[model samples]
Target: MKKYLIVGCGFSGAVVAEQLTKNENCKILVIDERSHIGGNCYSERDPNTNVMVHKYGPHIFNTSNKKVWDYINQFCEMMPFVNRVKTVYDGQIFSMPINLHTINQFFNKNFNPKEAEEFIEKQADKSISEPKNFEEQALKFIGKDLYQAFFYGYTKKQWGCEPKDLPASILKRLPVRFNYEDNYYSNIYQGIPRNGYTEIFRKMLSHPNIEIKLQTKFNESFNIDNFEHIYYTGPIDAFFNYKYGRLGYRTVYFERGEEIGDFQGNAVINYAEENVPYTRVHEHKHFTPWENHEKTIYFKEFSKETGNNDEPYYPKRLEEDLYKLELYLKEVEELKRYTFLGRLATYRYLNMDQVIEEALKIINE
Candidate 1:
């Protein structure tokens, strides 16, 4: 029998398994080094609260693709969700993305849309005519007060590099608003899977042609020989044995706590102040607002450096890392019958829906 192997059970791996299984001649076996599937978007029930908690972190499905949303609907119903994020700094909670309301609250002034626009113009750092780095870009756009409060410290702690060391592309992700809107994202579709993310992955790979092996790590020498083709979702640089040296990345350490009721009454709370140890806190119950849970679960997420030993999460795409990735590109070109996918594989951060959508496209291609 012709056999196929998937190195990881993430959405990327699952989508490939699903598409390959459609062929009656192929037998696909999926493997996840972790004891479970669903990659970082994995969700399960909390023993005490019975709420679906995102194991690695909160993974919201948000995208503009109707086809991707419809594809997800086949496995599970998605509850409508809006990512209303808040930023806590100087012991005050304000709306995120720095809208007109945020400006009013932060400055202690009642500035409507027109006034807010003028106020921001006055506050913007005029010294930075052409901003060179993350710090300069933020300062140029929002001025010292807003940049310091919302970005300066949080960004420094997150990347362990000064704002000058980082590129301006990071600050470009932040949206500036002249209106009172505070929604974190402008995406059309946003939601949490009604039955949890793991259930969706489970259903996606449940076909008889697919065999999932949990807690089974991939050993290329022995395992790769057994399968004719390989779809490796593990780290791309790691696959090349770190010949040009390991790529730099950031890993999040989550501290879970039991809450009697609600913690922040929001899904995500970003702590922009440098004094705070953790960057942001996620209230799991807030993710599923459709159902109310008496108890809540919250996570205090902290950033750490990703090395050869640590499980790579957020790829630190700076000068040095990109140079190393160029070397990885060479290694990938040298290979045959192997495709890398997902955050670990491509070395980039992505939301759950984006991961699924990208994987589907890869499979279709």
Candidate 2:
């Protein structure tokens, strides 16, 4: 029987382990530095309020891929969810994605879809035929007022830099809907696991052929020669001992608190002003609307440049970082008996669905 070592018991590792177990001849050993599974998506019930809280941060499972959705559904019952995010600017709350309702409310006009589109086209910076950075992209897309109100401050705070310094590709991910749709994501399948993400991992890794070891960190000490293959879901730079300079990443710090009643009616609220220290606030109870909770638990998210010891959340793929990532890829290609999987391994920002889809592809290949 071939023995395999998988690092990080998150969705990537867990899914790969589950898929590999079908072979029956493969024995899998999964490890994570954290005490729990699900990696950043780890969720636990709050002792004070008994509300299910995302330990690292909020994670909503939204994917258009039926295979990916169906695969996760096998482990836990996914309750229907649609993230309707709001933005607070100048003391006024507005719908996200610059929808028709948001456009009408922001300018105090009852313009329809055609009129709104024409108005925004005029607002856009036509002079910039090609956008080089995030600021240029926003100026060309939504114009000054909408960009400053919704994206400028939030982007600056989230990336810990001015919008102009970041790539325009980042802003392209956020769509501008002309209709009244306030649902944050457009995916066909969207929901949260009723039993929490940790439960999903528990059920996925329940195979008799797999063994899980929590609080175990992957390092140089591990005998790579022992396992037939190794699947690493950790930072690629860290795996190579940072032979090349560290790839840039942004980390988040959460300020958690419990409240008697609903703190924020919505699950997520963006603070779109540079003066505001935190980027967004998340209400845990709102995540699982299927269940009722007397008290609510929330988190105020703050973003910072990832430090050596800090847990990396988002990859900062600037020009220099991409250059470093290329060097790491070269190193990865030279290595044998190893495969890098997941967002951290690939050094790219990926949502929950994308991560699972990629892991499934890797195992299937």
User: What's the TM-score of each model vs. the native?
Assistant: 0.95, 0.98
Can you write out model 1's per-residue Cα lDDT over 1-365, one digit (the tens) per residue? 77988999888898788878775478998988898998887899999998889998878888888998888888888898888889989988988888988999899999778988899889888888888888889888888898888888998889988888888876666688978777777888888888899998988898988898899877646447768888888888778777888888888888989979988888899999898889999998888888889999899999989755666777878889899998898878877888888878888877767777887887778
Task: State in Å the error of residue 40, model 1.
Answer: 0.4
Instruction: Show the colliding residue pairs in model 1.
Output: none
- Relative to the true structure, candidate 2 reaches a TM of 0.98
Q: Model 1, which residues run further than 4 Å from truth?
A: none
Please give the distance, in angstroms, between residue 78's alpha carbon in candidate 2 and its true position after superposition.
0.5
List the candidate 2 regions with Cα displacement exceeding 4 Å. none
For model 2, what is the alpha-carbon lDDT of residue 328? 94
Backbone clashes in each candidate structure, one number apiece? Answer: 0, 0
Per-residue error for 334 in candidate 2, Å, reads 1.0
Of candidate 2, the 10-residue stretch with the lowest lDDT total is 169-178
